[model samples]
Target: MARLPLTILGSVLFVAGCAGEEAPGPGGPGGPPPIVDANGVVPNYACPGSPGCEKAEGPLLVGVAARPITPVLETWDDLDGDGVRGDGEPFDDVNGNGEWDGVWLAGFAAGRAATEIHDDVWSRVLTFEQGDVSVAMVGLDLVGYFQQDVVKVRLEAAARGLDFDHVVVTSTHTHEGPDTMGMWGAEFGTTGYQEEYIQHIVTQTVDALAEAKASQKAARMKVARGEAPELVNDTRLPEVIDQSIHAAQFIDEAGAPFATLAVWGNHPEALGSDNTQLTSDYVHYLREGLEERYPGTTTVFLSGPLGGLMTTIRITGCPDAAGVETCPQGTFERAEYVGKGAADAAIAALEGSGATIEDSPSLAFRRRSFFIQPTNTGLALLVLTGVLHRDVYSRDKKLIPREQQALLSLTNVKEGDVLIGTELNGVHVGPLAIAMVPGEIYPELWMLKPDGSSYIERPEGGDFSDAMPETPIQAVLPAGVTPVIVNNANDALGYILPQTQFDDAPPYAYGEETEPQYGEENSVGYTMGPTLTKEFAAMYGR
Candidate 1:
């Protein structure tokens, strides 16, 4: 743990143990009364470095709800407002089968529509309220969300008269879900987006959030952190992974647990690409296991800084039912093993870890956006050909040309100045400060590898090295404050890789025989890691 800043110590002591009362346990009664500020308005217990932390006077309130987002093939309608459905519009046979039902399952490039429904997918919402301000965190069982879609969710909720200071939407990055983003369609550059299905997600998310707010209850929070190395593996270069599993549980005043949020970094592809069922991957199993172990707890699994290829590739000693041993990777049994293993680790951490958030904890949120030049020509071609659905902005924030002809017509283009919108967010919940990444973030960008190696060598004149403790999480957060990265949060821009790795990776090729690089296949472009790290540091006022 880093050293806690002077201001952080003051803030923690300000709310520590709450006025002559013992700190409450996960299953204990409220510890102390709400502390009031000079204005008599309950002073928001803002952490030392948390920007835009909202203050409220009252007991903590939390609500948890979920809605089904499973797509009904029979009821699948026009999804993109393009007037007609499958009438010569670009539709790829993702699974390479002759028959095409126009459903592109995300996560795998071998485009396959959902052939069967293994289980119903869901959109889960966890809403928190303090005084007049409220924030909602939504988790969907999908591969990723575009920035436009992420913003649209907020806008749609607002249009429906739903009010919130912030509504953070993140896809669980489940490989088994429908292709919400257009990238995973049948063809290399085509889209399998169904507008109706997207609308269903938007509606379910808003509705669930509304119901959650309506079902608010006085709650106390307990946050604990533990490592589950057996559960996650890093497949990309430098072999770095964030094994830290952070669990935050909100216990209602009645002593019944309601909502639990867990953060980890492994890609949810435990079932691999061979299966054709619609599922939330290991996430569904993880949530089910956690809820079964602790009844009535709504569990939300968020991916962490796993951009440089973190996954469940370290398959060893996994066993299937009937006491038969299974392969180490890409099996349903492996998925269960990972999910149940994570649950066990979480239970162990929560049971004995002595980290307790206050009964009336402070809630604050901060967000900022930046632009990176699209350096990969292959990706640029996808953007130009109307294949990849991403909105590019100019230096002045004007919409850049995305159409093939328009982009081709422009001459003498400076690639670095052609901005792609990316964003980062800092959300403070009690003593936990969450750093949100819009894409899959490489763990090396935030922390140094266990072997003391780094993603990038220190620049000749730069003050900061490209390593952990120098990342957005450490730079923006005060020392001793709990920090976690919510990768693929709000928007899935793509893989945010370090500049050095980006340079080392083979050049991007749009043609049939592009050389395989470590992390560029799913990346937007290069140099995103440095840009995000700088912006995050600035956002937290480091």
Candidate 2:
């Protein structure tokens, strides 16, 4: 039997050779030496080798850095075909300074423009390194960035001399920040992606990542999760949600908090559709509250598997401020309450539980690429018109679908399904595992219902009702090792729905008229549900 080649990030690979047992390849003459060159550069992390080879050993250096990414409305397009930016431009006097602020907010599809900066948005960066290997995670305070923009940022990061094995970047999904995804532009179809704004974010993100890498110091890690079921709720499917707030705190040799990475599954939309202020919403307060509680500690919040339409419960009434049903409304005051609550939960988790803080934990990462069919007509049009541009390839790895406007569904570009290069990243630090998915994933797909049965609905070819099984993650991962899902990582291909929950077919409406499951409409296509599940399961060797 031939073993198919599996390459991770095109660096770590398993090649099927003729036979086994050779007279040792590099790394000196010490019994069966691990795969390594003369300089001791083991291409794969899971191989055997020197003191720090194939393992996350001593001087577990970790670093943190951040920089602001708030966009200033510098220019606007000539919407009316006029060369000037004076009359009939998208402007608002949000600050009440008696002048149009010229800024536009991102996230909501309601077309409400930004008026003032309520709070500063930032690009938070974290880097973990052992020996010659390094990997990073960058969290930007904005809606998601398309793969094209992400590639641009990575290229910039590399050009800036920040060399990393892999840099997993994700947006905080803040509805109050600048329009990075281009969906919530001036008008829905029209783009509000300013060249300056995009460049600003790219430059700032790279700078933050570089700074964090430079600041790396000897550290140890503590991973734990706390209950915060009340903080997160699924608007589409209330029963399916990942409410456990996970935190990974890194401490220095001196026992001082270095960096705290917290994760929760919920949309950062505390400032709702009508908001005109540029903010990070609850995410802003989440970081602030954590930093305040643990003085001198930098916190980065990564959104988890929240695609089952996870969002804060609608603030029908102001729970904190009495006598007013909606006194706080979508104000910062409300954001603070939600943010502080989540922060408190994360802090409790860090303090309450005892995590195996490993000074030398095994660190390994694997990244693989796959494709999905894009069935969304609107998104397909955007890709055709160049409004949205990402590298779309054929199954044979050719830059394809050359006839842009000709193919409405890139999924049908070739005889087979057109491949979209979506990546799956798995990183392990001792007993803790982190799965970085390219799109939004429903929690129910990874977690079972309280009744212990798989939470599934509306099956396609296979009936979901007949089920008595574990989730894909649970089935694949080792026992007692809970993998924290970080969705919208690397790329944003819209929502990754469960097969049963996918409602893209006619009768078209996802949720009930009153309860509207908007996530279905936002999905790239129906194939994403099963495709992602299968890919992840196989990637993890299920």
Candidate 3:
């Protein structure tokens, strides 16, 4: 594999080769033993070296890229473009198959789009030496909770026996994309591309790693943090004063912007569910915006746990508020909100942090897997209530075909079905950890500290149908670690209610609509990001 000729920005180095092998290459960074060439033979410094040969050189990078994966969610027959399927339904197959197998012709907008199986991917950097760090990134239409699709991660991590915990996976929270978890109680619909799509991710990342290995070089680097006002908001229905600030991380070696890893907590709902074409949601927008500011800079966008923090506030409040304005003193519609506030926060961070291309990071990344069981409270109840609609349209409005059987019919969730707790407080990118969770994280499950939540210290006996963050994640980074929280890094996992509220709310949600409990429960279900965070920080924070 060939490197993309892109400059690599990273911290730390891990020597590669046999387990008990002696140092067969040049001393790293400032280590000596390179100027004096015995026999004028520069050691083969990259890739696989000659058997036991003490001198050889090879490439050091893996590879990376991002693609588009979109799914159709609506048909024309409903006239309103809701999820309903009608006689004049667009994208319907009126043929004698008894099933709408082929796309039926009708009004263009009303037709449900064809199903897709591809996801956009990014970097796959493989480290080839001791003290070396490699990274790759990808963004797909589906969410990544279904670790089943992570077979590629296992294979790649094991390609050289690297730890699976070393690989990081994430998803952008675009409501417009296909369901990552089974929606409407059915697991068959494309959650974008699930476990079956692992090969593509694996292949792309493997190539990326090879390339990164080749592109390795000694370069000066600096990390600067700034806030962008564009990413902020208080879009809650009641219009409370909250923030979802966007923070940009600028990394440059030799005084140039090589990459921008931006962290912000907000739903990637800007691309609206009505869209059927594959896209990276607000990520596409932000990536392009950053690219215009700095060319050749690989922009890896990470999300935060924004369920409770976001307001869906409309831009500039131009459209006024959503929901019942007169009914309450200050109520805002859920959809009228925008994320300009988050972007603004990042702008602020950028302006305040100044710029740094010095003092390389001390990087140490490790990954592992655990069995996660679904609380199933949310899905089970939705199914019983006839809310399970396998063939969902763009707006999430339920559709019914007068003569067709329901795709949402009850079914058993097999071993491979997505079943896991959500990360209660970690922002994620491949191998990167975001420990900061700002906003009112339900105190029910978090172990709050000035540094970060200690999720691993959590008590074991409890049940949640409930929901639940923080502060700047970087401030809490361990003495030797630099941590950043990418808001909404996981999913639109709803609120994390306290334990007292858990028993009261069988299904947790974070809203006034919640029953009389310590915390509220909603249909969206509770999150485990905090739990995952505690475990990860305890295990990986060195």
Candidate 4:
């Protein structure tokens, strides 16, 4: 397959001042010079060096911490079934005093209120430090987290004197969690996100970071990869599934497990849409299974490139918690089955073929902020109507003040005039290279054969048929290194697929009789796939 060149120059910045060059003074001669991209914007870096660059001094230290972030439910029952909360709507008289009170469950559809708490959701953090540089990876059990909230977590951490070089806040994309992104409210255009609940999440996240930082201890690392395709189902045509599970296990001096960071590409929605109970879905079990396997060890689960709608929905014949062979969808049994199955796969890979890194492996990272043009009218309406609370940027990457957002309309704004500001992060810890994507990426964008060919073929009728496949993320990294592509890392802009496979307009691709596939409807726009792939490849100077 032909690869697309790095054409999105403004989105990527090259590292200046190579190794052996005189380190500039603090604030003058010895300090690092400002590195700018093609657009003349300064990019953030963990160290003053190239991509995956590191400056190690002391032994590697690792710590893990978690805090419950379940929201206190205050929801109004939709009596009229109009998908809107109104004055006449009845409240849960049994649970409360006939007043509206419940939490909006995100993912499948709107107005899905949480009836009960099956399991608690969490804000988990894994901290790493090898020298002066420190990085924090926060995993939240939610459908999606906006970049605006991520910024709040960073600022709060800084205020508490717990500053890290880079912080990657990711969501597990649990369909049963509270709607933090504001889309899945009681109605179609209404916002389900509660300001107080979002604040609670932010506070808990920062607390987890602080706790993790204080608990850091000297540790070693082990990296491994396993395959569990049977646990994942591709709901879209031209099926491509990322069955690989990447794990990084940290060990203390006594060889006791400190924490295990598992990365996989499957939506945590095994409980399905009709269920109203609030839970982390399969993620709760995935973490529980791992922690039980290694007592006293914490496990952090990060969702990977599950954009082509990789899920456990409709997957049958898996053993349930009671050892039953037949597990059905939308049941707690199915969720447990898939979660434990994934946990078992990771354990087998870690114990059987895990590779331990040398002591005190260097840690470094790079973060770039770029703009994605919005093409979906529904998404734009959500932003304009104040249903989606996020900062919008102009073509020049300037923030369009929220006050002025009301005045903007589809007729006034051109196709590329309005943009969404998001981030792409890359981290290197010894031989492991981690790509932190801002949304659910398609598996084809991350997985590639050794010869740089995709395992899946492009469909026949895409919007961009002549478009070349952007270089797969794994292909851009150094050879012989373990790669972990984390999706929904900093923000959730919906599905990120290849531009060549973007089929928003009919005649639909994959021979659909009517409308285009499901992925495009939730996506920000067609440019997401190309923009992310190009920027990611350029981040590594591919």
Best by TM-score: 4
Per-residue accuracy of model 4 over 271-356 as CA lDDT, tens digit each = 88788889998888889988999999999999987878798865664765885668688889889988988898998888884555
| Candidate 4 local distance difference test against the native | 0.75
After TM-score superposition, the amount by which residue 229's alpha carbon in candidate 4 deviates from its true location, in angstroms, is: 1.8
The digit string of per-residue lDDT tens for model 2 on 232-329 reads 66666546777778888888888888799988887888767777778998988889889999999999999887677787755443454554445354
Provide backbone clash counts, one per model: 11, 1, 148, 13
Local distance difference test scores for all models: 0.65, 0.64, 0.34, 0.75
Candidate 3 local Cα displacement, residue 507, angstroms: 14
Model 3 worst lDDT window (10 residues): 10-19
Instruction: List candidate 4 segments past 4 Å from native.
Output: 1-42, 48-54, 74-99, 317-325, 354-357
> Candidate 1 on 177-209: residue-level lDDT in tens?
888766667755566666677777888888898
Ranking by TM-score: 4, 2, 1, 3
Which ranges of candidate 2 are over 4 A from the true structure?
Answer: 1-55, 74-103, 315-329, 353-356, 400-417, 449-453, 458-471, 506-516
Model 1 residue 257 CA deviation in Å: 0.8
Candidate 3 — what's its lDDT? 0.34
